[model samples]
Target: MHSQDKLIMIYGANGYTGRLIVDHALEKGLKPIVAGRNKEQVKQIAEEKGLPARVFDLDSVEQVANNLNDIAVVIHCAGPFSATAKPMMEACIKSKTHYTDITGEIVVFELGQSYDAQAKEAGVVICPGVGFDVIPTDCLASQLKDKLPDATHLKLGFDSGSSMSPGTAKTSVEGLAQGGKIRENGKIIQVPLAFKTKTIDFGNGEKNAMTIPWGDVSTAYYSTGIPNIEVYIPISPKGAKKIKRLNAFKWLLGTKLVQNFLKKQAGKSRGPNEQQREKLKTYVWGEVRNDKGAWVTGHFETANGYELTYLGAVAVAEHLLANEIEGGAFTPSKLVDNKLVERLPGTGEIHFKPE
Candidate 1:
């Protein structure tokens, strides 16, 4: 068998985020095999980067597993992960290859967690949200839990200045169809769109954030043992109101015609250019409260979401290559550490306040 440590495979290497990860991997002096359903595009990127190439799709676990035999880690970047994560994850588990993805979808995180035992048994790690989706926020949650060990509830929010990638926009379209969610007493509870709003001071100033079904709703609970968890993203009052109004038409949004149209529109986006990625910033905040009402709040600022995704994803994959961590489904912070966010290329020091 070829040395797995030297063989990293990036599935979906032609997509917006995937290409960034590929470029970053090369910059770090690593030659990763680029693979995707689009044979021509994947091969083109591989040839341009002077790396190996493979072509495969998530049609079946057996098919994907066949392609993953010599791969040590597979960064599954293709999405909507709701449809893509399962087959790719199962393939990794079947092939006993480590699996990672930059997915922010709650179902995908939950799906990774569900395979924990199998992953451990297979001696293969399966971790999702290795990107901007939950790394910073998940790490923040872990830090807050460490600060307030008896915390009963956790709240997380993020403020980003970056625009959405096509994958992200398409994922947002899918999330809107599912409404909202939060973790309550260790159970996932579905709520209305923009179900709750709060003003959070994410370091710089006060920003209005609205509850969204972020991946941390699942990963944080597992990471912190917090019985209740809620994640929010910055939104204006007017935007929140508009989202609330969207509740009545959510069913319509789920229809085939509307979903297809929205997805097509989302596909048109090329995401941020190099300059925008360098200039934009993302801030993440977290608060933990115990029964006594004592709370600890903290926030950290980092690179733009897409830039951070590629950086975080590559960092985790490199960590997997260099170290021997336990094999199981994990949040990024769990697989790495809470300090992983701080170690990113463009992250500010974490700030915390006790109240």
Candidate 2:
């Protein structure tokens, strides 16, 4: 369906990424209804953008469900999704409305998956991690599996400019507070924050990446039937060293005080500003190996990951509006066609090498 006739609601529409999604949605000719707990903020945004706005408090499930009626889909952009996802998913399923979000929280993802049967029963699709946090890696893993039928081990890496938004920084802090995980020996294993580090070359240059708990650990396993998967994000050597040292005090991760302290520190240490966000580029690299002593490596470069996230969210909205998606909880890799990667707005240069 074209965006013009669809009634799409953007929850948390006042946040940095949420505002970008709203702007992109409007540019695509969609009139998005911005919603969040902050009615004043959302109202101000709507008034400025000439869009509609609503107030949605997660504490009130009935109100959320009431608001979901007649909406084509709800794009839940407010995160640390661990707290928001379950209630939102329940509301969508009850209202028989499609739902999508940019959440990369593994705990949130697992909780969403638990509602798959309910969503299917209600004929409502629940798709999560429809953003750079996992979509590229998830889609790439699916593509690699299609190429190598027997591929069993998956390693995905990416390096991008440091110009991250406030929401991204908050998400990173949340991830640091909650340690990451990786699939090893065909089983899921908890990993200390910044447990593993390696250098990844993105054709243009090389950068060091540390293991981060990416949502793909949940998505790729079911999508590609791969038991072992890991995702890494390249960081500066100095940052890597600092992370390594911090990881030694693993007990600190369990305390909310420590998490808040780190969050404050991250906010204080500015990386890139708005101009840098416009100029920054992102490069992704993936390697798939099997037990047969064969391996395949692929590289892709695109605009900044945040921009990709906005486009991906819009793509998801389009799919839901058109009824192109099946009713169930799914990751982007499982719900969308690999070919749609071409339709997605961005220049993705992909190359594969054999080893």
Best by TM-score: 1
lDDT of 2 by residue, 151-210 (tens): 989988877765656666767887775577998866668987777888888656777788
Highest lDDT among the candidates is held by which one? 1
TM-score of each: 0.98, 0.92
Once superposed on the true structure, which residue ranges of model 2 sit more than 4 Å away at CA? 1-5, 236-238, 265-274
lDDT score for residue 202 of model 1? 81
10 residues in a row with least lDDT, candidate 1? 1-10
Q: How many Å off is the CA of 259 in candidate 2?
A: 2.5
Model 1 residue runs over 4 Å out of place are 1-5
Cα distance off (Å), candidate 1, residue 89: 1.0
Deviation in Å, model 2, residue 216 alpha carbon: 1.3
lDDT assessment of candidate 2: 0.80
